[model samples]
Target: MAEITLFAAPGSCSRVATIVLEEIGVPFTYELVRFMKGFHKSPAYKAVNPKGKVPALIVDGEALTENVAILSYLAATYPDGRVLPAASTPMAAARIIADLCFCSATLHPLVTRYCMSVKIGGEEGAAAVKAVGAEAMKENAALIDQRLCEGDWWYGDAWSAMDAYLYWVFGRFNGAGYDLSPYPRWQTHAARMEARPAVQRALAHDEAAQATLSAERMQMGPGGAPKAA
Candidate 1:
């Protein structure tokens, strides 16, 4: 396989896929798209991802957008890595997809929308957006916590792409002050995910980004809310 290159930004959804790559032991490169500099919105970056978002995977010269697609593709191509189940049946695959959707459609988006309300709309709309977003995320987090309570991983016994995404979203919320004390299982999940070698690697790479994020959160006053990218 051609070396996979991930065009990513620190603290972006792309980081989830990047961590997947690390866990799978795939050789890859990561290019940081500086959010503060608006590099992701640049014409150069847009050429790679029309949405101009981070976490675009370049396999050879073809770019794959969206963390869900990239993660699934990596798991499919590297079955030996076993980061996700091969799914002996279609129904099994459907279950994994369902879990992934909970993260992508519900958890991830809610966090992103709330944090970036000022950029998506304006400060005038932020409070209303955050109120709705928080309720939605809390509900979504509760659902995932329920799943974690049932099993060690999001997809039963094995680690899956959904686990990586869920863990990342969980960290984002807790780090931003959503109060993980209410969700004990999810808090435990975050702690375990952080201890993984792959996750630790991702965090090391994301150190500078985390600093910027901390500063941004302080500026936002709660939520680590951001200007929408």
Candidate 2:
């Protein structure tokens, strides 16, 4: 097997790939892309991923982007690893893909809109955008919470890659002060994800990467000049 390299950013959706990789129990190299510092837009990184997105997986010298595609690839390549649900039938497989698509295409953008309303909407319009995004997020969260209330995992009996994606999204919004108290089932789902060893390891790596970035930023003064200690 060829060497696998994962280009990721801490606290981003890229963490999904890291968690899946950890679950796969395969040897791979992780390269942190400091997205907050605009490292993803650098020429070097742009060469790797023209879209300038995190979670680019380099397998056999070819780069793969997007959570849906990458996660699907991992699941397909390592059937025995069971990174995703082992669909017993064609319709079952489609349902799993549908859930993944719903997360990426619908839920994620709403969260992103709320989190980056200032960028998505002009300064004068940011408040309106955030308000609308929050309402939509709340509705979506409720649906997810209702589904999760039925079982321990999203897909009834087993944990799938969708759980990792949902956990990250829910965790991000919760951290951003979204008042998740109304969604106890969602909270419990996140707690269960936190209890997973692979998730714990991935979170530790994310925290360490974030700390390193924070320390590096602190060393620089307000204008990007080195601070005199």
Candidate 3:
């Protein structure tokens, strides 16, 4: 068995990977990367993941970054279809892969640009970007809601890591003060995800790490920079 260690930050996109790890029931060490505590920028963490991002899965001391890559790995390594659904063909495998890309490459950046638009761009630019984000979010939510309405999960009857990733991205929109009531179906799906034992466990891991960050007085500032703890 490979010794695994996950360097994760609480409540970030890393939550998706954390959920899958719990779903796989794997034995791995959780190394909290306190982003606000300046650990992510630390030399030690950079040694682990040069990108200095959270949710870097270290397997036998080798690093794997990105939610899509990490999820794909857990699926391939565990081969239990817990991280993802077992595909009979390459095309079937690509289905979920495409969805992951949509969430990570597409929606993820939109939410960040939307939520942090004011910070990223000036007030005038913020208005322009916010409108774009709103429109894009609505279009994506409609597609997601339509698909989710067909099945209990994204694939229409099976729960996969994609669900976790969707929950994270969609919830980020909601968290950013965008109304999700229009997509009641995905909202319900989000609630269902929240009720999962595995999800709860992952959230627990997140909360514990956040509590530590809070105690250390290293909460991120208004501009996303770490404040002195």
Candidate 4:
């Protein structure tokens, strides 16, 4: 068993990586990177991951960053044939990677803009950036909704890492007060995803990480609300 340790933020995009690990049935541990406390930008975390981002996986001491890269590595290394398609199914594996890439490269950027335009875009231009991001996100949501129309999971019968990834992505949008009801298939998919045993386990892991982060004095919002920014 490789000594896998993940440095991740609690409910952030890193939750996708945590779900992938649980879905693969890997014995990995979370290091509890508290973004609210600036631990991700600390010297220690920066040493582990120069980019100072969540979802950094330290596998037997070698570090891998980025959600797509981490998920791909897990799929290839674990060979679970579930969280992601196994290499034996070459085309399926390739498609999963592409889907992960789309989530990482395409969807995530829009999410960043939609959720953090004030930080990335200037105060004066933040609203405009957020508007554009919201529009683009709707387009992508329709695409995902179409994808979900095929079946409960992205690939129909079986669930993949993409399912967990989308849960975090779309869940974030919903958290930001977006109306996801228009995407009926995706809304149904969300319900099914929440009901999964593996996803429940993953949420437990997230709560554990959250407690650890809290103990470390990570800000629990001004009045005990959630804190990612």
Candidate 5:
């Protein structure tokens, strides 16, 4: 077994970890959890990550949850990769960590809440919640645009996991039915990011999973519950 193993679901924020692992040129095995069946909530997975979040990494037998920790671990372990700041520059590393937290903690969850709130709150209440979520999405998008306008990447000219996380969160806007044209810089960032081999590979994997799930649902007929790929 590979020393580094990642438990992830395709198209989730776990994609960021996949990108970071690829960027750092680290080899690892992927353990895919069937989310639709509540695989993440099973006892077996809780041993790996008690929080039950995707992108949990088992490195040298110690499981690390949260994207920031996993990403920073990869970058720092492979410091020569140049995808992250040097440990010697504590301030720089701190800034990148900050950006990672903001995106993971704030931007990503807002979009997720907007998407799933209907299940928690009733449909009528969900509409109002989603409205607020949509506006927040725009504000976050604008914030990212302003950052990109100031510089090519979030931290600096060199791309880092921050850019990858930004790409993942902002990409959610398209599904949320937000107008992306206003954030030209974000669009440009997405274009540049899509050209990267790592991101391309991750996205292709996600799309394939979605297609497979769709086909399976079609086979099972109307009574069959469509599983989230």
Candidate 6:
């Protein structure tokens, strides 16, 4: 078994974990869990994580779930990786954790609600639910854009895991057809993130993995039925 095995779904929040792992330059294995094919819900994957979520990390034969927990673990285990601020006091650490919490608790959920409004609110009310979520997301984005105007990175002069988390959130919103042009600061921040070699590498890997999974699904046909010749 590899020292680390990250079970992830391409294009999901798992990209943040994969990017961090790449940034750390650690030797590990990546197990792709194709969300498109419902692999994440399969019994096999449920054995790894009963919650059926992506971004589960297996470290030292133990399973770690949740992005915040996994990120904290990586930071603690590899201090040199500099995934978070090197806080000298407890309050300082709390501040960093608070930033991460805001992303996970506030930003992520708002975007997800907007993206999955149909599922959350039923077909008849999906549009209204999505509108509410979109409005909330716009407010949150404006706040973040203002904060980003203060500096290049979220914490000013330092790029941390929070940046990765925020980047993922922004990417999700963008894909959902949210208008991001008004947030110039965020646009710049995203550009810088994309320029990172680690981020680029993770994105490339995710693209390849997603493409391969799509091909496999096609070959298997719908509901695992073989395609006509």
For lDDT, the strongest prediction is 2
Q: Write the residue-wise lDDT of candidate 4 on 89-133 in tens digits.
A: 778667767888999999998889988889888999899988988
Better of 4 and 6 by lDDT: 6
For residue 108, model 3's alpha carbon misses the true position, in angstroms, by 0.7
lDDT score of residue 119 within candidate 4: 84
- CA RMSD of all predictions: 6.1, 2.5, 4.1, 4.0, 3.1, 2.7
lDDT tens string, model 2, 56-124? 999989999989999999999988778788889999989888989998999888878887788888898
Off by over 4 Å in 1: 208-229
Q: What is the TM-score of each candidate against the true structure?
A: 0.87, 0.92, 0.90, 0.88, 0.87, 0.92
Whole-model Cα lDDT per candidate? 0.78, 0.87, 0.86, 0.84, 0.79, 0.86
What would the per-residue lDDT of candidate 5 be over residues 155-182, giving only the tens digit for each residue? 6588888888888876776766678899
RMSD of 6: 2.7
TM-score of 5: 0.87
Count of steric clashes across candidates, in order: 1, 0, 0, 0, 0, 0
